[model samples]
Target: MSVLPLVFTSGWASGINAYAVVLLLGVFGATGLSDDVPEVLQRPDVLIAAAVLFLCEAVADKIPYVDSVWDSVHTVIRPIAGAVVAALLAGQSGSLPELAAGAVGGTTALMSHFVKAGTRMAVNTSPEPFSNIAVSTAEDLGVAAIIIFALFHPVAAAVIAGTLLALGLAAVVFLAQRIRRFWRRRAQRRAERRPTGPGVRHPVPTDGSEHF
Candidate 1:
């Protein structure tokens, strides 16, 4: 079976939740359900570490501004994790070149990361915490479902991931454009409200003699 699909799927998931992808892949490898997963990822220590981090993320991701801060910190971590996982999967399966896999994985992860981060920032605008919790829960469940399904049907999973990624990027662009327009209008209003510049003369009342 070709590993490219799994690579792309995992890369997309990793952008949202790296630890969950690692933990799920580790379990799949340890259970002997998938032979494409790297041996190192299946080790007991690695699994344990992934589990702990996953739990941490699961909690932090539910908070409003905290989630945004967490996203900021993981900006670098997610793409790296995606690249490493893709390289390992390719190297183990020998179905794709390691460098090529890494490049694809890293680029995909970075794009998806922007989607997740931008969405979170937008969601953070809501004063209620429920929205944040709901969004975070959905993301976690999404990652789990995609990774699990990828193991059984990689091609379909990749197609789904790619479509979702495209939609997400579109949403981000729309939001950004809206925000830019808002700020531009606000600046224009401020400029209009300003007092007239120096040297501009006001109408003078004439009483016998008006000063020129």
Candidate 2:
């Protein structure tokens, strides 16, 4: 059904940018663009709140370590948001059961969230700053496009979102080994750089003046 496709699409986008998806949906409903969206999402206060959070995410998502922390914090939030949104849509549409929609939305959101978080971990392994910004920018754009397009063509939007989700998951799996190695090397480097306390001792120095 159209409701199912819309929920699946939104669920995928929610994993990457839940606030953005919520804000956009609220705006669409408030503007009378889509009757399928629930009034609860279109309230003035809800739109304001979603917009504020979306702005916060837009900024925090561009920084490397900050983005990872953001992702970690949203691991639970995103999936719940997806489920609530799906349930509301289903309740309004009367095409699908609320519980079924919630399950589909929440499960898809969880899977896509892991894919996103894992991909970020792998990307952060790179020393460059631009990659994080680029990835975050792309995700925001993708979420907005999918949500807007889903308003008119839910099934097509779902197909695109599903494809992207699958690609992201595959990329995460492929980079799992690299992600592990990067963390291990980083830990070793930190230990090597750690300051020696008054009671600590070291092996032969690297300086020629202090030979083995």
Candidate 3:
């Protein structure tokens, strides 16, 4: 089977939650559920590491500003992970060059990562944290579901992933100005609420009688 579908699907998922994608793929491959997954990923140590990181991400991703921080830290990590996974998938399938697959995965992951990070930054402008948590949870679940779908129906999963990515990017571009305005207003409000420092004040003359 061609690995292009899994490459795109996994790359997209990795951007949102690389650890979850790794753990899901590793578990499925280890359990004889999927043969397309690489042997290295199915190793117990790899699965354990991915699981631990995923748990940490799950917690960090739910917090408002913290999720943004986490995303910032993973800006490089996710793309690299995506590339590695894509290379491994290609190796397993023997249908594509590892270099080309890696390039596709890395680029796809970078685009999706930007989308996720930008959306989260905009979400962080809001005072409420529920939206952050909800979005994070949805992303995790979406990654898991997509990986499973890719295992069974790679072409359809890839198409869906591509559609979602396009929509996400379009939405981000459409809301960029609004997001900027929202943060600007929030900052302005914060500045207005800030306490003023003590300072000497000159008294105004009344009836032109107090000029000094």
Candidate 4:
């Protein structure tokens, strides 16, 4: 079976939540649930590490500003993970070069990562935490579900993943201006709230132009 679909799906998932994708692939591969998953990923140590990181991400992803920080930190991690997973999948077939697969994975992951990070940054502008929790949960569930589905129906899963990636990218582009404006407004609010120095005082107009 061509590993192209799995490669795309894994790349997309990794961008959103690399640890969750790793954990799912490891668990499924270890249990004989997925033939496409690579053996290295199914190692007990790998699974354990992925599970721990997934847990940490789950917690950090539900907090507003913290999630953005987490995303920023993972900017490098996620793309690397995507490339590794793609290379592993390609290795299973021995038909595609690891380099080619890694390039595909890295490019896809970078695109999706940008969309994810931008969306989260925009979301963080909101004061409420519920949206963050909801979005985080949705991403986790989406990664888990897509990886599982790809095990049985790689083409279908890949199509869905592609569609999602396109939509997400479109959304990020459409909202770019709004996101920028949101940050500008936030900065303005912060400036307004900042306390002035104790000695600072407004000068009185002696010309008697009415002080509003």
lDDT of 3 at 52: 95
> Which candidate ranks first by lDDT, i.e. highest?
3
lDDT of 1 by residue, 67-176 (tens): 87798899999999999999999999998999999988888898999899888877766669998899999999999999999989999999999999999999988788
Tens-digit lDDT track of model 4 for 148-174: 999899899999999999999999998
RMSD of each: 9.0, 5.5, 6.7, 5.3
TM-score of each: 0.83, 0.88, 0.86, 0.87
* Clashes (candidate 2): 0
**Residue 153 deviation, candidate 3, in Å?**
0.3
Clashing pairs in 4: none
Better of 1 and 4 by lDDT: 1
Alpha-carbon deviation at 16 in model 1, angstroms = 0.5
lDDT of 4: 0.89
Q: What digit string (tens of lDDT, one per residue) describes model 3 on residues 23-123? A: 99999999999989899999999999999999999999999878877998999999999999999999989999999999999888988998898888778
Q: How many angstroms is residue 176 displaced in model 4 relative to the true structure, after the best TM-score fit? A: 1.2
Candidate No. with top TM-score: 2
Model 3 stretches with alpha carbons more than 4 Å out: 181-212
lDDT of 2 by residue, 1-212 (tens): 55999999989988888899899999999999887789999999999999999999989888877787898899999999999999998999999999999999998999999998888888888889899999999889989999999999999999999999999888988999867865786588789898888977767666677844
* Model 2: residues with Cα > 4 Å off, grouped in runs: 185-196, 199-212
Which residue pairs in candidate 1 collide?
A: none
